[model samples]
Target: MSKKILLSWLFMAILCLPVFAQIQEPVKFKTEWKSVSADEVEIVFTGKMEKGWHVYSTDLPEGGPISATFNTDKLEGAEVVGKLKPAGKEIDKMDPIFGMQVRFFEGTATFVQKIKLKGGKYEVSGYLQYGACNDENCLPPTNVEFSFKGEAAGKQTAEEVVATTEDLALADTASVDLVPLRIGEDTAAGEAADYWKPVIKELSSFGENVNNESHSWIYIFFAGFVGGLLALFTPCVWPIIPMTVSFFLKRTKDKRKGIRDAWTYGASIVVIYVTLGLAITLIFGASALNDLSTSAVFNILFFLMLVVFAASFFGAFEITLPSKWSNAVDSKAEQTTGLLSIFLMAFTLSLVSFSCTGPIIGFLLVEVSTSESIVAPAIGMLGFAIALALPFTLFALFPSWLKSMPKSGGWMNVIKVTLGFLELAFALKFLSVADLAYGWRLLDRETFLALWIVIFALLGMYLLGKIKFPHDDDDTKVSVPRFFMALASLAFAVYMVPGLWGAPLKAVSAFAPPMQTQDFNLYKNEVHAKFNDFDAGMEYARQQGKPVMIDFTGYGCVNCRKMELAVWTDPTVSKLLNEDYVLITLYVDEKTKLPEPVKVMENGTERTLRTVGDKWSYLQRSKFGANAQPFYVLLDNEGMPLNKSYSYDEDIQKYVEFLQTGLKNYKR
Candidate 1:
């Protein structure tokens, strides 16, 4: 009975884990008002936050979290005596999420507002707004409303207490309910417009027919598999393959037993790497992974780390774990028996081959962690491990294949050196992100293109034996395979030469700096969005009777630039967007401040949109339930989606079909 009870408890715990992860509210509040004197009253708002979560102080600067504020709608027969002030233990420090200095409060917070009451009955009601965040995620700004009704410096008779409906001035609108404002509606009485409507439910039906989740996972897996295949050619991993297999074969007299052990060894590799991926996700969380990948400080660190790895691959030095660690793992494998021994052996290989595989794994994580999927890192590692482990099991099953395998030679070092060049070139991309974010202008388009051109050209020269590295063999000659690789590299370098003069290199647009950064430009043909404001664009589309194409993009989004350069540049797409549809490009990362902040009620929480980017971002989330960039949706004049939305696809024909579908729906 006890065992059954334990099993039931474990099952319920597993089910509850997901429910806990979905909880977004971390702070709770209560409010009270007290009479301080015959003519004075104090309103106190107290908040208790969850552990490790904090609310930003009332004095944070613009561009950070929304500072705490007291909003008032009605304060009849009373005037605020002083500013709303906070009484709590406040913390001031630099915040990594906003990349600036901020002040916040944790645990408990108290805010007091003093009001002087006129000599009559009075009423006061309003809401308090603030933003909260933890290390991993930031919640939308939230509001807590308060109301007080009392009489001050007056003794009312029984007849006076029995007042008419007009004398009992109640709130016109409920605190929780919002007055919906239609698009292009006039407000003669000065009612605020409801900009963020709950359009997500209506938009769901339009996109229900389209699904890209499985395709995205497959793509990431294939990329990691290719990286694993490349690592197999490195000198460190290739030579060890034979030696590790031989050890497994000699350990057991029975060939079947040896093959089974090899299978276990391969499985162990997968488990180790996948666990590492899971550890990363569990430690930093999905939201933090996105933040870390795009952070300027993280990019700079990644840039420096990649440069060091590239130098190691160039034979400047070796990057490896301590000898004692590998020795200890190897010793454990020899001492242990059965499955444990196999896992230890696999671990030993992982430690020993770190110098070759570490860079590949690091680069793969950096690329995939930008995605919103929490399991992306683990899925990528799973694919990589499977590819890396395939040969061991295959060779064990067919020993004759080992004799046919190519002998390790100077060619292995050649592949490593080529990878070094690629790493060196890719390292600049991270630095470019940081440069663009900080407006440093250090690696502009022309300068970035010049460096890439030189790197690929030098790589081509190295492949043709025109240059020598520290580990290169003196007798290295241009073989057929090497010759073709050199040809391709030289061609790629020539292709990018046009980019230095402002030509968009569509093939490398995903990696190269944007064309706007280039000083010189010869390319004149490019598609431009008609409007950046959502309401203005929708109004124009309504007047023209054209469908609306809203392009949700960002400055730092790599795939958005890829689609723009690759598909939007096509004549057909350009013409369709320019003529048949009203194009609206909303940049979610744009930092320009709005003329005046707008109050929006989204997901039952009030959010303050203080910047242009914040307004667009709120529109995307409240309207479509998506926050990723390069999101394209076609809507009618009423702002209802006409067709399935599109995201990050570079196929020009499919994009054309998407636009046509929306146009067809609109005409009907």
Candidate 2:
């Protein structure tokens, strides 16, 4: 009877083992902030695990158990400079549950995130998400919230703490007189006003769509189509159109059958190009290509590639595939029948005409890749294919139309050489991006304009038959078409001359180095922001009893510059901003550190303001719920919205009205 009773108790204990494990928390976390430099701080998270229990590290592969992750729920005054780093005695071994190698800490784990403060004071708040496991059981992912605040690095705290009389008496004997700083005062009344407070709820009714939608894909497609049209005029492609059509007409006695074959051939061309685009996307992946598009190495490589293509177009040498490859493709086309044979023939054309079309296609693909859309490459190719293939099918359907087409001659070479010069000019733009990123300053705005001017002038001369390339015919007289093109080129060169002296030259602002880079400029008839600090600007506006216009912009914003040049330069708009409103321009990308971090509760979440930019960005987001740059808001002295906000619209009249409405509202 005693043995049976003991066995029953053992069974119950075995069943209750997992229940006991569930009731006990295995890991405890403690977070601390360590000032690493005058402008940097490190948030250290230390995790203590119970014996035989472990927690996973970050960056484990997918399809495995959850890995540790640190999520910043609120970041205001400081920027996270680097990734979270883990340190401890980690056990990296394969786990049967995940069937993969996993890393975890057994006794203790330390994670650190280094942050750069825009100002001396900063507040950071986030949660650590981790999963703990043991030999027989696994714990679900858990979150531990952390909040930290610190002053400027190396700033000793002067905070006074009250203590009991006995504790105070235990201090070292030093004769000192302590004086009270303030007594029986209303501290709340003396506290500084918060400029970033949420506006009245009625202001929400005036909100506009803050989303900056992109329509670049449509532009990219049309650009590709234009490129295809240009490629069709090249020497290699123009001559082949008639010959290919003639062969198709002669091969089949029935004209309808011949036309059908031509259509099939054109479709094959599109398939070939579209497949090439899909291959590029699949090989590189969208995320990687997006990153690569902005990388310095990618920009430099594209610059060199364009230069090489330009040289080839200048008649330095032909860029062609090996003869054997085309020969082999031609042989297969002859052997095959029906659509297969037509596809092979189209493949042959692609290979043979690559010398002429290769540069255009390469350049098209390069530009399209920068759009960062996964399907952009393929869409661009589709447009190019339709434009290229249209001529072949149309000519075959109407054989008589072939005679009206312009004969391939010196004009074709002129087209090619013109493209060469344009390519050379555009290559500089790519180099400029890399130069700015690395602070090389080798190719400044003036230098770039000079090169473009010289190149375009030379191109104009070439069009006038005064300049000759290697492939040009010895013709002294220029065609009427060439004369007009030359005039346009010279006119464009003349237009850019003013830009050298720091003219906004709104036309080329997107490509040119910013006006700030120019060393010499005479154009000063522009509007300037009255203040950059929110608090200072708001207080001054209140004293002046004027409306406030907050311009949320960025250092690298292209549209912001365009708006300033196009709309802000208008006399009416400038007058209102200068006289009727106090303008505050906040650069969201500013890197200046703040003197001290300011803490505030925003939307029921704590936010730390460590930099000037952070304070402005937080204001824009919390109050306006907008983060995109070139954001404009009109407010009264009390921080209430005066009118609807504006964005990248450059309509001078509309902008004038926007300002007038706000000024009128402020007066009311």
Candidate 3:
């Protein structure tokens, strides 16, 4: 009887053991509210997790870990302005169980949400659902209820209130600061008085799109391939092709071994170039590369570097690596056997041809480094190396083919001189970028167009044999290819002439600075927005009974300019943007500083919003969860989205349809 009683007790203890483990709470929550404006209040939720425990962020992907979610009990009197933002540092790690990346907060975490009050005061009740985990175990999902009272604050005198309300109605909180109105203002002078008010737009996230990143990689790769083809024609590289292949063919007894050795040499060249690219990526990192691409100092340095390269191409000097470096590699090739010798031979070729290939490689690297992808440099180098290596391997396999190839002559000098002029023209582009970014106004649109016109005209004259550099042949007659190139250059020069007098010159718009940089203008593209501030544009839209089109753009954004010139310039799209919709262009790269800095919690981290650009960037990220430029969003007067957002697509018909759809939605 005693043994049976003891067995029953043990069974009961086993059942209760699981229940005892569930009793402890590993995380605690606290909530509070702060007033931002008369109509908007910010609700902050802070979570404190026990030691060795963590709570997942709201943005974590599903099927990996449970994320924290927030919901309001009632949506009648108040509405959430944007997504719930994390207010503390987050730890991102790969989850062993789920086989994916997960972001979680350890220790303490804070989240914030903006709530806009429609009218009268009420209690805003909400519940946060979250899951906590530790190294050993994960607790079951839990919910914590939270509530905060909302009240309109910052009420002013009747005169102040009237002025403040009017200003607020016309101001976008994202990019502009609100200015208090003065009492006893003249009604006739109201338009002038309104200029002083600050514009505001709610801040959001500015993350880069994944698809755009992939597209950038493709663009860089193509650019590098073209650069390599151009490099192959330069005086330094062109002369070596026949000699390198012949050396390999004569050195080996067996034809098969010669072909294999030549192939190995080409592969070695690719490895060397790709390794150089990898070294650059490892040294600078993605973020630093981006910064370097845009930095004024770096741009200026590149301008100088290209200028030096141009002079070298013009025969002022030869830009070559150390002779000893090439000799050392050449000696190794002479001594070593098999693949090692072939690789050293290829290394010698690279070193000897650096005068021509170095500038091209440098330019390509600078261009590719701006892309968001870490492997962009490597991909670009791969493309270039393939183009550079193809000739050597192919020539080796068919030594007879060398007889059909153009003999190295004065034609190589002509190619070098042409590249010199081209390099000079491209160098101006980097200088222009620096000028525009720093607001120096040194390279204005008119000046830039004038310089380009001269450069191309000179190039045309040079191609026509009217102008001669140091190494040009005395032949007066131009070849058919050279004549056509001269004609093309002259045509391009003539096209740019009209741009000085304010022509759009849409073909080269991506390379040129903004039209706003032009001091004089005759042809107006009509793409400029009526209002750049969101609230001001929306107010005008409401009064005119039109929908709002928000253009998220940037001064530094190349694709934004491309879209403007290609798609927005279309008559149908232009007409809709001008008449049917209230266009608001928010420049995310605007350099204007905010009158006062604002520090706010974003994605669980505190960041200082110190400029107009930062505010708009934050607004875009927080409100729509988008951070890329050339992003467009259409909305009704009450701030509701009218249709899906648009990105860097240039299909005019699609853009027109997007506008029409938004207009149709707004009407409904």
The number of the candidate with the highest TM-score is 2
How many backbone clashes does every candidate have? 0, 10, 23
lDDT of 1 by residue, 529-561 (tens): 999877777767777888899988765454566
Q: How much lDDT does candidate 3 score?
A: 0.71
lDDT of the candidates, in the order given: 0.76, 0.73, 0.71
CA lDDT, candidate 2, residue 192: 21
On the 0 to 100 scale, the lDDT of residue 418 in model 2 is 94
Better of 1 and 3 by lDDT: 1
**What is the TM-score of candidate 1?**
0.67
Candidate 1 overall lDDT versus native: 0.76
Can you give the lDDT of residue 653 in candidate 1?
85
Candidate 1 Cα errors over 4 Å, as ranges: 1-220, 250-253, 278-298, 331-337, 365-378, 432-441, 444-446, 494-570, 583-642, 645-653, 665-668
Give the range of the ten consecutive residues with the poorest summed lDDT in model 3: 162-171
Evaluate residue 597 in candidate 3 and report its C-alpha lDDT on the 0 to 100 scale.
Answer: 59
User: Candidates' TM-scores?
Assistant: 0.67, 0.68, 0.60
Candidate 2 C-alpha lDDT tens digits along 306-351: 8999999999999999999999999999998999999999999999
The TM-score of candidate 2 is: 0.68
Clashes of 2: 10
Ranking by TM-score: 2, 1, 3
